[model samples]
Target: MSTTVLHARTLPGDAEQRWPARLWGVLAVLCLVVFLDGLDGSMISIALPSVGHDLGMGTASLQWIVNGYYLGYGGLLLLGGRAADMLGRRRVFLIALGVFAAASLLSSVAASGSLLIATRFVKGVAAAFTAPASLSLLTTTFPEGAQRNGALSVFSLFGALGYSLGLVLGGVLDGFGWRYVFLMPVPLALLALVVGWKLISRDRRPRPGRRDHADRGRRRVR
Candidate 1:
């Protein structure tokens, strides 16, 4: 007599699945980063008049404060993605996030309009790196299919919410001081950095077998 045996094959993303709590943590951390990006972008609009008044900046000079940030963000966005691919995603994200926080702190205490605009540009450059890295981390962390779709929906929601809240918060915080708008994100970013360090998975190094295979393929092509 002969016996037949059957083994089930796992789906593509099955092996990458994490516990629900950990998945939420990853999503939250990424969401927070996106939130900060949106917040910083919109928050200053409400505070701009106050900033101009305080710094005695003209309209033309005040415009640069906003324009400088967008210039840095739009210019380097593609480079940020390439960086994440070459370096580890988490490493790039965390480092950029730190830079964003530091820039935010400096912006709050800037002695001149030029210094403030410079810091805002730095913040935007940092954000360019962080925005892509956060998305890369999110896609890699969550497997494709329903899980990834749901996580993405939530991730996008935080961005819109952050912008909305920033508008309101900008008005409220500006009442206290224009500086508060810049200062608010510093603590939140630091918190995300600390928590992300623990929750986000480390990047996988290339296997020796795969490296050798790739090398052999390249040699054949050449």
Candidate 2:
């Protein structure tokens, strides 16, 4: 009898994939931004009564505050994702997050109902960009495998937790002032922005020639 041995073959793309050394830090930053986006979406709902009373906004005008956010969020969501693909994901995420933070600060000091609603709309647009960019960044950062799946689960958990926690936090912050509800996210956003800039890797744009070649190859394949 002769002894036989077989060698295992490495799958395609297996060699090209690499996980970042600071993956946990990157994931945490992504999660924090996602949580803040979710929190901002719902946090003001509970503070509406206080807002209306303080700002002298009627029920109809107050509704615009909430509607403004949803309008911008839903309207630009698809465009935001496309923007991330064309522009750099890291760049889009950082810019959007910065806008989100600034909008939060402005909302806190908004003198009129119209100004506050506009700030909320801008925040929603920023969230639309950040959400997709962060998700795409997560996928690229963690190679496809169990680790990526686990990271995704954690990321999703934070998003849901934010919305649920927002209602509770809104009530608590409302006790101080309606403005406090808006102010709460400002610090969190700023912290995430700073951390994200440090932790997230820079996007590598393909050289013009390489990109043209890639497009040609894809066209041939199609």
- Poorest lDDT segment (10 consecutive residues) of candidate 1: 1-10
Alpha carbon lDDT at 129, candidate 2: 96
Q: For residues 27-105, what per-residue lDDT tens digits would candidate 2 score against the true structure?
A: 9999999999888888899999988988999999999999999888889999899999999999999999999999999
| Candidate 2 TM-score to native | 0.86
Clashes in each model (backbone N, CA, C under 3 Å)? 0, 0
What is the alpha-carbon RMSD of candidate 1 to the true structure? 6.5
> Each candidate: RMSD to true structure?
6.5, 6.4
Instruction: State TM-scores per candidate.
Output: 0.87, 0.86
